[model samples]
Target: MLGPASVQDLGRVGQYRFGVGTSGAMDDIALRAGNILLGNDENAAGVEIAFAPFKLRFNADAAFALTGADGGAELNGRLLPPWWRACAHAGDILVLKAMSRGARSYLTVAGGIDVPLVLGSRSTQLRGEFGGFHGRALQPGDILPCDRSESPDDAGELGAEPADIALRQRTLASGARRIRVIIAGEYDRYDEAARQLFWHTDWRVTPQSNRYGYRLEGPPVQPIVPIEKRSHGIVPGVIQIPPNGQPIIQLRDAQTSGGYPKFATVVEADLWRIGQAGLGSRLRFEPISHQEALAAQAEVSVYLERLRASVRLQGEL
Candidate 1:
């Protein structure tokens, strides 16, 4: 019931088989962090807000956590920080300022949003218009039902541990963004010069970038010889090169398959970086071995486990 633009439920995972796009949160790490703060399932439904000077009036008391984007959240006129959790009484107004960093923010309420799950997920597939809050972005006067009963007493006021706050700051800090890629599919088709250019050149995200894919603007990457490839199954993170020589990084809402030549696939651990990268952001690619990719994922798992353990311990306090 608030925003300056584009809000949707953070993606539907595990339902892509029905030709549905996995339209979840762009910054999954933030979504998981907020849910953990509120003791909700890491994948529990939450709102993904983009480009916001967002405001919402709560009609009921609730515990909520705000994560992603340093939007300068305020509850009842009191300033709040990202990764912070707090309580809101009935009629309290929550205001989130425009994004200062990162492209999206997540609002995870305790007990999660009480929307009917379709195919085991509550994410909105904007293209298909199903699932999520009436299959659309929330509007003013729209009443969203939440599972208030599922909220635990300690969910609010816990805030973020000093360590957690530091972690978020470090991850979202501005700098030359390096995204790791595990080489896959048709990578050999490109000539040596193009391959070197891919790794060494800085690519700028064009305005065409969206949840569907990021169309990058940089030096053209051309294959040594013309090749025609049939469309095959593809998933998020695959870098496809079209005839125009521009690179397109398929995202959560990407089509299931494409005829474009696939050069490289971003590792799962680094997709969140892409999600937070806005138009005009500079990105560089780093090649990693398959083992390195697996290790990266393992590191993420350990970090999540620590978050879970910390929340559990706090609940017992």
Candidate 2:
């Protein structure tokens, strides 16, 4: 493992109210797609690989899917394409080389990784260390157990169209990915110029970015007048502007509360795009109405449903 690799599902929902943050797969769509391909539960736990050059050996006959980044994976030396699924025999080695696109890759088996649910989720809480496999990342010699009861018996090699292709989004002329956002409570605190800067600038994802949040590099987005507010509840996708003026996008493992000035929020539908964005990537923000955001979310739902139906049809054949 080159970077953090941990077991994650869709994440704990209701428990977040109890001070536990949701720590699920960053590229949730990828993970869900992998599970769907293998006929596993949509929220089945899978190994989320943040970085590449990862290798694993199956101890038993099984099927698996590789989704998210195209990391040049090879199953026992046979190259596999991104979003592809295939079966493996005992002792088969799966190796993932460097990623060519996106930031993370998900390895989902025929059955989800067998890990005890903590706070109703198997996702790793790196800070709390209470969930996932020991609530930590996978290290060498770490063997993961899988619940193979749901493994499909007649699954042949299957491939899925990547999310980027299946759900295309508009991009800025500068080639920066355009992420849709909705204005937040403190949007009016910033002057028109600051708002324009936030909208027009191609923010660069800094090295400080992680699952906790993404620290963007760009012209400062300071408010018109200094203002202080009490810390309030926050969630993934909330964009907060700190004293230094840089924007921080709270993500999957972000804290439950923060005091930073709210700017805008990346819609849930596009959170996967942010998750897949590699370090140093440029992203442009496009402000949209709340209704538009909901529409975008509906579009994603439709895509997933179509994929699920198609996979089920294939299995029936």
Candidate 3:
């Protein structure tokens, strides 16, 4: 076992008021797609594998799906393509090698992982250690329970086009991933040079980046004057600029509140892209209006709906 492998669903909601951060799969699109393939709830709990060389043995026959970053998965030595789904018999072993593309992968079963829900979600809260399977990452000898309400025989081999390809969003000409952001309250506080540097330069994701936040490196983006403010409520995707000038985009596991200078917030629709960004990868930010952000979210919704429809048709056939 390698990386922080843990059970996660869509995320914990309606609990931020209590200071609980939403801890969920970084690449929610992958998790949702896997669940959809297995005829499970879109938010069904699945294993989020951040790193590779992961090995698991099926104690019973069950259906499973592999989605997200291509992990080069294999079942009993048979290679499985990314976003592929199939059945596994008792004693069958699934192995995921080092990821060839994205940063995370999801392994979802027919009925999702059977972990107790805390605060209305089954996602692992690593900081709080109160949810998910023991609220921690799976170890070598750990045994996970799966809700096998659906039979393994029901689902044969199936696959879907990866979200990136199927959705087909706009990209940057320079080839760097283009992430859309909405200018936050502190945007104007930065001088012209700092603001221009932020928009023009491609920010490299640093090795220190994690689910809590992505620390970016690029030209320093200093503000016109030193400013201090009270810690305020924050959500995933809020971009903060510290004294170092490098930006840190808060993510799924970010704290409920922060006091850093907010430069911008990556629209929710584009947060998944940041989740899949690999270490040392460069990202270019494109500022969009609030209306455009909503449109982007609608596009995601349409994509998921189309996927659901396709899966339903396959089931009827």
TM-score of each: 0.91, 0.98, 0.97
- Candidate 2: where is the Cα deviation over 4 Å? 1-3
lDDT (Cα, tens digit) per residue for candidate 2, span 84-189: 9999999999999888778899999987999998888999998898889998988989999999887767589999889988888765689898999999989999
Sequence-dependent TM-score of model 1: 0.91
Which one is best on TM-score? 2
Model 2 lDDT vs. the true structure? 0.90
Model 3, span 149-197: residue lDDT tens: 6655658888987987876657777778999999998999998888889
Better of 2 and 3 by TM-score: 2
lDDT of 1 by residue, 22-45 (tens): 777777777888888998878788
Query: What's each prediction's clash count?
Result: 5, 0, 0
Q: Which runs of model 1 end up more than 4 angstroms from their true locations?
A: 1-14, 161-174
lDDT of each: 0.78, 0.90, 0.89
Q: Give me the candidate number with maximum lDDT.
A: 2
